[model samples]
Target: MGSNLYDKVHIRHLKKLGDLVPDVHKAHQGFAEAVMKDGVLSVKEKELIAVAVAHSTECPFCIDSHTKGAKKAGASLEELAEAVYVTASIEAGGAFAHSANMHNALDEAADDALYRRSSMEHMKKLRQHAPEPFDAMMRFFQTATAEGKLSVKLKELIAVAVAHTTECPYCIDIHSKAARKAGASDAELAEAILVTAYLRSGGAWAHMALMIQAYGEE
Candidate 1:
């Protein structure tokens, strides 16, 4: 599946929403607007993380675009390389560190909860300042659902998995209930999540393969 995520552009966290659907530019914008408030991590660091994620997930568009974005956010070529190297290091590190069937399960679960809550808070804050992000959000939703051939349920599940992984509890609760009510069962929902997880892991494997081949040069 990671082999299929062929994005070549890199966007900030907000840009991820836009990248997923591409029609509702504001869906991307709203998300970006909300998350920008945190100001905890430097913009460069955030963009760097996004780029690393794109690399892991095989989002070529994200990788290319975020490489540009990262530069704009103060990431140097060396820094970007280092960041991806970190991604590589962590991934390569994982290849040998296989431990539990549920790798970092407790931490992952807690991360999910945190993501849901935090995203909700961010959205809430964004709306308070912007005052009309909903209309744009709706438009983004409609375009993605109608044009992308993405099911409403699939969208909800996508939201759920991303929210969970990103630790946005508000989004998790909202999307999870929506997904289940829309007919995604426990198994279906879990499958969606595992799909997300597998893709993440498999993405690293792709990089590992690359590194293995490169190092084989000698």
Candidate 2:
């Protein structure tokens, strides 16, 4: 944010955005380093890909930054425009793909109305102060995830790294507990953290080769 781009009006608009936007300021350092080091693509393509990924992430700040980056990296206006469109399309597709998950959870939630009523009855006296409806909502999720259709263990492990990468504390807490419940070893969790760190570090160096190749052309 101390950089020049954040000075621009468009970017300022994004920084002032509400809670829905992912924290780009936190993500930028890792993002800048990650792809350049580990990505096999050119800077131009990488920026464009970042542009598309920004859309999927629903981060307006990221979108603005990557759109600028793509243009600077030699992506044409049309290319950047099309990348946004493609991003939207893929996100819309994901909505459909994820609907089954929603339906599965919803059905499970409703399937045990008697159980829900009983739980509420039990809760009225247990703790004068109790957790809100969130736990009740999560019961449906626990039930649905327990079914063999979704491997809760594997999914929890995957979700933890993704949550940390995305900087969601709630997600990190929830998924880490889930991973432990699923019997994931502390070593595996530590390994996952290292993997994210490695990816973040490698991204920057990977692009240094571009500077080398450019110099070689002389």
Candidate 3:
């Protein structure tokens, strides 16, 4: 198939990945299966996390695949939408959260410590800089994360997982606290983290197809 950088994914290349590394492919499949199994969280919940992490990786393949998985696992479109937005918020939050570093760097007299809770205050500057969009995002985040079909606790748990994958300390702090307040146990939190681990790894596994195209068969 003739394709360029912006073309929709040509899935034929994906099948070739199985041929490229049969063992690794098989193991990855098995790991994905095992990871999604019901444990502290249900498979429906796991699929939601998959969808969320897929957004973080910016992998269209994983996003579509796991959105279907979430639907099949009994997730409503509303629930799926919430999960995707949780991802959006966390990924967006990563950039917003890391702005603390920018704030610190700007202060010539600031301490060597780049990330301080106090620096989060600098986010208020957005209200002055981009009032409309910043306020809109905050409102959207509140709506996306509020109690709904998935429950605040469950949403917070998913947020925690996405935050970890994105490595946003502010998001991690905010959502972990929310998760705990919503009665998420340490065990449940751990399971969510594991789901994030699998989904993050699954992204690389899914992209082996691109590698197969790059390294054509012998």
By TM-score, the best candidate is 3
On the 0 to 100 scale, the lDDT of residue 52 in model 1 is 54
Write down the lDDT that model 2 would get. Answer: 0.48
By lDDT, the best candidate is: 3
Q: Note the residue pairs that clash in candidate 2.
A: 33-203, 33-204, 34-203, 36-203, 36-207, 37-202, 37-203, 37-204, 37-206
lDDT of model 1 at position 168 = 39
| Residue-wise C-alpha lDDT for candidate 1, range 4-123, written one tens digit per residue | 333221112333434555765555345445443224334554565556555556645446656787788776786565545434433432322222212334344534332333333333
Residue 79's lDDT within candidate 2 is 63
Q: Cα deviation in Å at residue 8, candidate 2?
A: 4.0
Pairs that clash in candidate 3: none
Candidate 2: tens digits of C-alpha lDDT, residues 50-134: 5555554554555666678777787788666555544443333333233334444455554533323233333233223444543
Compared to the true structure, candidate 2 yields what TM-score?
A: 0.36
Rank list by TM-score: 3, 1, 2
Write down the RMSD of candidate 3 (Cα, Å): 2.7
The CA lDDT of each predicted structure is 0.48, 0.48, 0.83
